[model samples]
Target chain A: MPINYYIILSLTLFVIGIVGVLTRRNTIIVFMCIEIMLNAVNLLLVAFSKMHHINQVATNPTAGTEAQLFVFFIMVVAAAEVSVGLAIIVMLFRNTHSIDVNFLNRLKH
Target chain B: MTIIQILFWLLSALVLLSAIMVVINRHPVYSVIWLIITFFGISGHYILLNAQFLAVVNIIVYAGAIMVLFLFVIMLMNLNKDMEPQKSKWLKLVGAIACGCLLLVLIAALKDIDINNQIAETNTGNIGLIENLGTVLFTKYVIPFEISSILFLSAMIGAVVIGKKD
Candidate 1:
């Protein structure tokens, strides 16, 4: 497939994620939106890596290996992030009895 | 049209639809479910691109493990109902408008890019195979791989510290 198609599809998913983050009040939903954005970027990276690999196949058979590895590490980091983030969210709910992002405004005080 | 092209369009549609549903679904549990579907759709895309390793990892990590964690948390908090307080209509409208403008600008900027003719190889490429990726990972990328383990350790400790009862 042409790279542009992948780019457009990824862009649409990312924009949906941004809209979710901006419009949603629930902190968990906002976090999920962030995950969506991350996945969008992941998809794009894979597409670009394949494009690069095809272009460089004669000179370098493993040209796109790094990008896939990078995607692997991204998944690693995202998993760790979700663990810590959910722990924080659980604690927040326990203390405040709510999960609304607006409830965090008191931190400004 | 080729089978690959058809599959690409189909997976893209599935991903976009599920992602939008994840955002607009009123119930948090349903949102999580939609997100899982979105992940599966993306995995299908990865498979179409011949990145078999990443596709499997995406399903195992994102759909199986992380989403289950999300569901568990939601159930633990009894958040199954649609209890999320609605934002003002104007605020939502503004957010949607801003995102739409951002999308418009990005499309305009990227539409005429020189690399649009490039084609990502589908259903081929051994670099995405586990053997090649493993060799590179243990050689050139070994240091970062080890550091990631340490990062995971730190994250584990941090989560426990923050989650413990005071």
Candidate 2:
């Protein structure tokens, strides 16, 4: 498959994520959108890894291995992020009784 | 077009549609469901690209574990109702337009890149296999791997601290 197609597809997915983050009032939905954006970047990274592999397979058999490992680490970090973020969201809801992003405008409460 | 090409397009359509649905759905539960679909579609793309390890990991981590956590939180918070207040029409329009413009700019900037002729190796790459990746992970990337474990530990402790009621 052409790398351009993957790039365009990933870009569209990322844009959709941005739209979700910008338009949604629900904090959980916004967090989900962030996950979507992360997935889009992961897909692009894997695609690029394959592209690099195809180009350099002659000299290096494991040409694109680093990118895939990077994706693995990304998943690790995202998991940790989600745990902490959701805990914060739950705490916010416990105090504010709502999960609206607008409710969080003021840092001083 | 080859079978691989057809499969790629199909997966791409599935991913994009489900991602949009994740944004459009009013109920957070439905959004979570749609996000799972989106993750599955991306996993299909990974399989197509022959990154078997990442595909399996994506499904297990994103679709299975992470999404379950999301659902648990949503249900615990009793957020199944459509209680999300709608943004103003103008604000939504502006957001959509901004995203569209960003997409256009990115496409324009990347359309004529030098990688136009390059192709991603699909259905035939040993580098994506688990054995090779495991060796590289334990050898070249061992330190970062250990650091990520510490990161997970800190995150766990932070969650516990923040989530504990006063």
Off by over 4 Å in 2: none
The lDDT of model 1 is 0.95
- Candidate 1 C-alpha lDDT tens digits along B1-166: 9999999989998999999999888899989999999999999999999999999999999999999999989988998465788899999999999999999999999999999899989999898999999999999999999999999999999999999999
i-RMS of candidate 2: 0.5
Query: Candidate 1 on A1-109: residue-level lDDT in tens?
Result: 9999999999999999999999999999999999999999999999999999999999998899999999999999999999999999999999998999987888699
Those runs of model 1 whose alpha carbons end farther than 4 Å from true positions after fitting are none
What are the models' TM-scores? 0.99, 0.98
Residue lDDT tens for model 2, B1-166? 9999899989999999999999999999999999999999999999999999999999999999899999999987998565788899999999999999999999999999999989998999898899999999999899999999999999999999999999
Query: Candidate 2 residues A1-109, lDDT tens each?
Result: 9999999999999999999999999999999999999999999999999999999989998899999999999999999999999999999999988998987887866
iRMS per model, in Å, is 0.6, 0.5
lDDT score of residue A21 within candidate 1: 98
> Model 2 Cα displacement at B57 (Å)?
0.6
User: RMSD of candidate 2 to the true fold?
Assistant: 0.9
